[model samples]
Target: MIKLANYTQGQWQEGTGPGTTLYDPVLGTALASVDAGGLDMAACYDWARTQGGTALRALSYAERAALLKQIGQVLQDNRDKYYDISLQNSGTVQNDTAVDVDGAIYTLSYYAKLGGKLPAHVHLEGESQGLARDNAFASQHIEVPARGVALLINAFNFPSWGLWEKAAPALLSGVPIVVKPASATAWLTHEMVKDVIEANILPAGALSIVCGRPEGLLDALNALDMVSFTGSADTAASLRGHRRIQHDGVRFNAETDSVNSALLGPDDSDAAADLLVREVVRELTIKSGQKCTAIRRIFVPESRYEAIAGAIAAKLKTITVGDPRKPEVRMGSLVSRQQHEAILAGIAQLSHHCEILFNGSTEITIQAEAGSACVAPMLFGAKDPDTNPLVHQVEVFGPVATLMPYRDTEHAFELVRRGMGSLVASVYSEDPQFMAQAAIRLAESHGRVHLVNTEVAKVQTGHGNAMPQSNHGGPGRAGGGEELGGLRALKFYHRTAAIQASPDILNRLIQNAE
Candidate 1:
């Protein structure tokens, strides 16, 4: 089998030590072996700072943006190759793979176009403010590149989109990047990076990939460096407490998993009921419910609990679980055997507090061979979710969700808050007042909330989809950071400084002297 290589110091080097084998989730066939034992940690950082940082910082925003546009075109022209690889490694159908491949291309192009409109200099000057009573002294905030490398630790669920989304802003801000993709799905990311490097679209060291264990990378960071992570909360906590991070004052941004929820209001119209059922099922089955923004908890009015549950259960029964390569399959296997077993354990724990409304099954019939890691969709309903701590706190991280009944609008708000904080939430209501009130209440705990009604339901983007134009992170358990909110994401890689001086001095410093 081929071994995955690490791209560091502008070269591809094979790993040392015994490596772990990666398998195809749909075929149970070995794909590659990954290890990072032979790589030099300090040299990698030094190369990025000296070689990569110098090349990127020398270019103006417009010049860098043009480079990004060329890269985007190259990736778009070869998207089919990425889709084929994703189907084998990720166990996703064409549609699911498009979410990663197409999403990445769009983000790169968006940043390319936006960067041209910005100022040529690396620093951006805010509106000047007069400080003295006679308006003699003025101050302004200026944003400039941090002049350090960005370390990106990505999740396995989106190998392509995850890397590009973070890389776009970092490159746009004139900062280089070192990517550490999750080991399981690193092949796709590795392939994409290889394409970019071969095309010579980026500077020699501007972008690099470390496919295996990120053993000593963290120790090499300094105070000026920035780290962005996406994974479990446990991993986030461990990284946040690293001694080097504290000593160097590295900027750390994390986006972790949370039990995101969706609310069904008291509206009993067929429009509301149909929209609610359709959206719930869609979120549960898409990407096998591995999305960080997927709905893990469902809150409904006491009177409509049974009706909503029945409607969702009926819709789920029609879905076919099998290998994504087969055209008839609606849902594919989990990413790997380990993830499949983890989801099974989570279901067992949740079953203690709730009754199984639709236990699709532990066994499944699939078009692929028997070794594939496939599991049926499972749905549990809790009569008194407000009292069940597990229902409110535990996240299955797969095709599973808990349905609970709420007393009223206040009760719904309380249940939603129990999630601590989430990346996204949804409310299905036709009543204008109820929708407005619920949105305000839920906004306190969620980064984004989707309000669906009869007129907008047909065109609405579902709850699990994170757009490039909106902020994707949330507060509390979801990780207190913001990402991809237009130009806001670029600020993470830049530092802001306030400059106070006379009007003439300020004008000269800003390079706008009249």
Candidate 2:
């Protein structure tokens, strides 16, 4: 079996404790073993703060962007090898794996674009007063790199893109990175990290990885350190409120799974309905509905409840469940047995609040099949929104969606808002006026809104996933944190300080560059 090791301090380090066995979902056989026992968290932090940060700061913004482009090119050169490893990580098809593998490279490429487009200098100038007392002060703003380490805690789904989104900005900002990928599919991330090391794109100690758990890792952080996490609200809360993190004033940013919803416009034609069905089905089956941004609740007119579910259910039925490497397969298995159990448990919680409409329960009959865990599409019908608030409160992280109906457009927006806060909400409409009204009303409650219809539907990223260019988080129970909004991510990596003084003092400070 292939053994997984941690990449730290410019070398691969062996684990000190028990190892976790990695497997293939299609074959149910051992592929590798990852050891993550006795990692030196303190030393890891020291290396990033010193060696990593120093090298990155030496380069200018344009120079840094150039390095990122080189890294992207290197990733493209070895894309096939990364895709090969992605196939075994519960990805049921090549398209699914390619999105994760290539999407990461694209994210870095986008960062290079951002660096070239954004202004290098920000000038804060005071307005000139009347005649002889024409006193004006000039303050030049310089976008400098954060002089510390960045700690990234990513989710299991989209492991490659999840970590790459954060790494691109951190490195570009002249900060080093120490990543902690989700344990479920750390091997794939490990492989990608190996390529990053071999390419010599990043300086030694600029990027590091710890495959498994690193206990007491946060305690060693300093004021300049940053923490970016993407996961569930419960886990986010525990990490965001850590004793050491709070005491040391370490920055923390989180993107938690929320009750993301989608809507069908009032003037939507039959074509709109058909488009909605396709989008919904894609959200439910892609990554087995394991995405944090997956549509958990769907809002529609009371008259079209059965029609929407029936159309979507048919598409779900056609999805093939087998090895992700097979070209014929459209959907893949969940990441692991433990994740399968968690999704089922979440489904049970929803069942208590809503009735099952379409049960996608089936056993795998393909080769190397292990029937120990299997989940097909599950559609829940929540007829009444007021009867139980739990329907909007809980989420079944699988190929499932709860269909909720409303009397009119106003009622639809209200029901959508009742989910507390969400990461995203989408409305499909051919009418521009209706789309405008719905988007304006729902925009406050959701971090993202896809005002999609036949016009932009062809290129839509769909309703269930967040791209690296946009913010992928929400407010309230949806964790009320943000991540991946271009350079907004850098806000979490560095500390912002405001200095109040005369122009001469500021000039002296800038001129005395130590």
Candidate 3:
């Protein structure tokens, strides 16, 4: 098996000893292994800050954007080669792998184009303020790169998109990056980084990846560095409590899993129901519902819960689950045996409070020889959502979702808010007033409120897709972080400072920024 190596100090480096084996969820074959035993974390961080960070900081935002474009092109050229690696390491079908691979290239390209609109390094926040009585003295707020490394600890799902989405803005903001991908599916991430490195598009230390155990990963970072994590809430809490995060002033951003919801409007039309059902099944099957924004708790009006549930079930039954290499298999296995076990345990936990609306567990028929990780889609129903806290509290990260009933508008909002916070909450309705009110109510806790009707049913990107134009994080249990809304994503990697001087001097500073 190929041993995954960490890229640091301007070269590919491997661990000192044997490490964890990465397996194909289907067929249970060992694809690769990773270990970080011998690598020097502090040295890697220092190399990035001094080499990559310095090289990047010397260039203008536009130049950095050009670098991003080059990197994207390289990935696009090698795109076909990544599919087999993804199938082996991630257990995802071609389409799902495209969601991760193609999506990353798209985001990088988007940022490359978006950076053309920005100034060299100084972005004036607003108009200058007259600090003194006379107009001669003025102060202006400007945003600049933070002069640090963007360290990312990503989850198993979307290894490609997760890294690029965070890296695009960070690199555009003139911050170098050190990525620590989850070991279970680091092959695709590793291969992508390797391709970019081999193409020699980035400056030395501009991008780095450390696979296997993150033993001294956080410890290597200091006050100048920032971290963006995507994983569970418990893991976010642990990272937040780290000394570097709490005491040394290391900036941190998190996109943790949450019990996300989808609410149906009180006066739902047939068109609205049809859209909701399709989106629901798509969320469940795509990437096997391992998405951070996947709909976990679905809330429907009590009057139409039965009808909607049946429709969703019938649609889900059509999904083909098996090996991703086959053309007919739409849904694939979980990433690992550990993930499969966790998914089962999560299903068992949710089953206590919900009745099975449709159980596809027994219907999963693999087209190839596979292991026990293959699981079919399963749907559950909650008769009363307000009382059952577990349904809102637990997030079963798999191709599983629960349908719940809410009495009315107020009850629906209450049920959704019970989730505390979510990345996205989709509302299917055509009523202008109800849609408006739903947006207002749901936005209180959700990062994005997807309002759907027949008008844009065909055009609206599915609820789980985190488009580059919008924010992709939420408050409370969702980690209270924001990412990927056009240029706003650069904010996390930038530092703002107010410069006080004469108006003419400030104008010259802006003019001479490059």
Clashes per candidate (backbone, < 3 Å):
0, 2, 0
Cα-based lDDT at residue 389, candidate 3: 84
Per-residue lDDT of 197-309 in model 2, one digit per residue for the tens? 88888877899998877666788787778888888888988987887667777878777877888888777478788887888888887887888788888888888888887
Query: Candidate 2 has which clashing residue pairs, if any?
Result: 92-324, 93-324
Candidate 1 lDDT over 1-514, as tens digits, reads 7788898999998888787787899899988777888788778988998899899988888888998898898889889999988888889888788888998999999999888888876464558899998769988888888788899999989999999999998998899999999988888898898899989988878998887885688988888999999999889999999976766789999999999988888876678878878888888888888888888998888898888888888988888887998899988878899998999999999888899888778433556677787777888999987678888788988999999999988988998999998998888888988999988998988888888898897798788887778888998999887789788889999999888989888778768411
**Ranking of all candidate structures by their TM-score, best first:** 3, 1, 2
Q: How much lDDT does each candidate structure score?
A: 0.86, 0.77, 0.89
Ranking by lDDT: 3, 1, 2
Which residue ranges in model 3 land beyond 4 Å of their true spot? 363-370
In TM-score terms, which candidate is top? Answer: 3
Residue 456 lDDT, candidate 3, scale 0-100: 86
User: What's model 1's TM-score?
Assistant: 0.97
lDDT of 1 at 388: 89
